[model samples]
Target chain A: MPSFFTGFELAARLNAETRRRVAALARPPRCVALLDAANAGMAAYARRQQAFAGEAGIVLAPEPYPANPEAVMRRLAELAGDEEVDAVVTLYPLPAGVGALEAALALGAGKDVDGLHPENAGALALGAPARPPATAKACRLIAEELAGPLKGKEIVLVGASRIVGRPLASLLLDAEATVTITHAATRDLAAHTREADIVITAAGVPGLIGAGHLRDGATVLDVSINRGPHGLVGDVDVASLEGRSVTVTHVPDGVGPVTTACLLANIAEAAAGRAL
Target chain B: MPSFFTGFELAARLNAETRRRVAALARPPRCVALLDAANAGMAAYARRQQAFAGEAGIVLAPEPYPANPEAVMRRLAELAGDEEVDAVVTLYPLPAGVGALEAALALGAGKDVDGLHPENAGALALGAPARPPATAKACRLIAEELAGPLKGKEIVLVGASRIVGRPLASLLLDAEATVTITHAATRDLAAHTREADIVITAAGVPGLIGAGHLRDGATVLDVSINRGPHGLVGDVDVASLEGRSVTVTHVPDGVGPVTTACLLANIAEAAAGRAL
Candidate 1:
């Protein structure tokens, strides 16, 4: 049977570290969640994030985003200038007219905890000192924790989203891992995955991979969170890999918790950095 | 017989387009080549670039770089403030103390003609509208010119350089190609390259790849400019690929001219953009 890598233990460990760091800080780290509360989904996400922040001794303020692009930019600028705000994260699926890149630029490098700003993104890509996106960082952390050092490891990452796969590619490469970025346009996905020592899936498609798609004893990190009939599901078809020796992380109890913990850790870092 | 893809005709065509665009502008485009003239090799490169800029009816000004990081940043900021300067390109292999990312950040987004700025590099990585690094752009242009559309092709890029290989991976992904980025730490280079539809080599090591390393009929784009006993040489061993059906672009005549032409084109675009 495949050994499932649940994120609960790792999340707890990281949260503990984050809590200790926050306690040492002069003031609680204040993180602004710039999101559209009009969307029930985003509101729920913000509420969930706030719960996590409370546990970490961090203040998570959910600021409603304006629909207008200019107003959105101005709001971000305001947050950036606020000394009390240690970090600002513009939630995805931003109000229709507001652009992701523009919002990141307005949030500025100092407070953009999401690390979506081009400067941070470029720094990550260039192997410079910069905060990487929380989810991408979480993926790396999980992979490294489960497997050994990534140096020279063969990794095939599925899906090339700006938030995840794109940034993860650079991070993995910096770790000296040989990475192949495959997406929807990829012709033979399994051919690449089968040969990879580690397969990371962020395609958001349920039942995307099975035993046949992977080799014996390969480590899989699933980053996709899709709503299934039963509950929240991940990209991989966990049921299909039942009797294999593959090591994998399942959806709900896997990357999700760790991602939240990583975000909190980033907020703590951002707060600690301000004192420097 | 193998088909050799020379950058001459593509460069001439691009140069003609740039010249026409420059002629249509209110005044000749002004480009500043911020380089360390103290380095003889860089000085020769600047001269070559100047000659190309002249053909495109653009003024290429060579600026001597100060060794101090702060002074270098101030110089970049001054150039950014100059209304007369259309584009600014900070040449690589900068003087000892200055950092590449810091210099790129100081160059500012609007005038970064070579597209090394974080904003531009980020935009390119995110598949947003922005200028891409010229060398990466040149490689894509040459590849697309030879291979119809990159929609479903498999490309193996050797070397993970921030300037060329890193940026090229994103561009190739944008074109819908499955890109595998292998670098010095990659254990088995031939294992990846042997099955690739296209092999793009930017690794500076001479004769790093031979006919045995590539698939039959694979297209090779060499971006390295290493000084050989004979003269300039590329990463690919052309003699070893003599009788294959493979398509390739050699070092001196391949990516070099196209990169220069692309830089000139970017300068023209930057100059024209200012009017908007």
Candidate 2:
């Protein structure tokens, strides 16, 4: 069986650290969250966030998702200027017709805890002031924990979602790793992965990467969280790919926990004001 | 011998079109250029820009590089709020200690014609409201102009500079190309380029890519314009790599002219107020 890399351990350690940082703050960092409706993919995340915020000693204020695009921008713009709100993050769905880009732009770059703000995204690409997406950042942290450094490593990143593959490529490139980014358009995805020292799949399709997708001892980080018959799963078939002499991060406890931890980290940084 | 791709033709066509765009504007789109007195690399660029601005009927205003960090931010902050300014750009040698990022951040997204502003960069990454770095955009334009959609194409990008490789990757990813980004740390760069249908080199090292670097009939765009004994050169040895059946763009006329054109495109959009 493959040696499992668990975000549960990393998240626990980070939470302990977050508690210390929160206590050190002059006042509890005020975090305002826009709770997405249950139909949206963020209900589970919202539940986890509220519980986590309490443990970290930060004030988590929840609000309903705005009705229209105008309301979305208005609410975000309002929170952006409020002195009490040090951080602002919205759930996955910003109403049916709303786009996250517009809503994120309305949120002040300093208060954008989720790092969905374009300013944060630009900072990540520029290798400058960083407010990277939590999930992508967690992938790098996991890779580093397993492998010493990503320098000179050939990494195959499957998926180009702004949340994962895109930002992850920036992070890996910053680490001096040669990165190949493939998506749904890519033909023969395994051809690229077969030549990689590390393979990270965030394609969201369950069992998209099989045991044949990796070579012996390759490190695989799965960022996909899908609802499979056997509870939650990731982009790869972890059960099948487990015994191929590969290292794998499981579905339930893999990237999910670290993503939550990184969100706390961003909130802490935003409260501290990361701008130079 | 490699086939050749020339930007001179594209530059002429774009310039001819720019003349009409400039005539259509209510007033000349006001451009602010912040120049550094020291060894900033933009002295030659500013010279070309002045000539180009006149030809295109755009106003080019020069400003002294601000003194300190605070002054840099303050000046950019002032420009950010000014309704009269359509675009803002800066040269490399930013006084002594001024960081480009702080100045860029101060420029605000709407007026950052060079697309260095964090918001613009983020938008480029998120694949919305695209105001990509001029040179990067030029590469994609050249590629698409030669070959149709980049879908499923294997492209090897030979640099990771903020100006070119980084943003180009985002644009190409949006185009659905399988992109492999290599930087200074990449070992055996030739091996990667060999498998690519398209190769782009912006490494800034003169003669960094040679004849052996590409396959037959591959499309190569050279963005590096180095000042050699013979006036100007590029990252690839055009003289040497020219006969390898590779479509090589000349150094002086390849990516340089297109960059200036793209800058104008951004200014045109900014003048019209691209913000929501």
How much TM-score does chain B earn in each model?
0.95, 0.91
Compared with the true structure, all predictions reach lDDT values of 0.88, 0.82
Candidate 2 Cα errors over 4 Å, as ranges: A36-44, A61-63, A66-78, A81-84, A274-276, B36-44, B61-85, B239-243, B274-276
* Candidate 1 residue runs with Cα over 4 Å from true position: A35-41, A63-74, B36-38, B66-74
Give the alpha carbon lDDT tens digit for every residue of A125-242 in model 2: 8788697889888999989887779999999999988888999999999899999999999988988898888999988899899887888889999888899887888888776764
Best by lDDT: 1
- TM-scores, all models, native as reference: 0.95, 0.91
- Candidate 1, residue A274: CA error in Å? 3.9
Per-residue lDDT over A125-221 for candidate 1, one digit per residue giving the tens place of the 0 to 100 score: 7777878899999999998998889999999999988889989998898888999999998999999999999999999899998888999989999
Q: Pick the candidate with the highest DockQ.
A: 2
| Residue-level error in angstroms, candidate 1, position B160 | 0.5
Tell me the deviation in Å of residue A240 in model 1.
Answer: 1.4
Q: Compute the TM-score of each model's chain A versus the native chain A and list the values.
A: 0.96, 0.93
**Compared with the true structure, what per-residue lDDT tens digits does model 1 show for residues B141-207?**
9889888799889999999988888899999988999999999999899999999999999999999
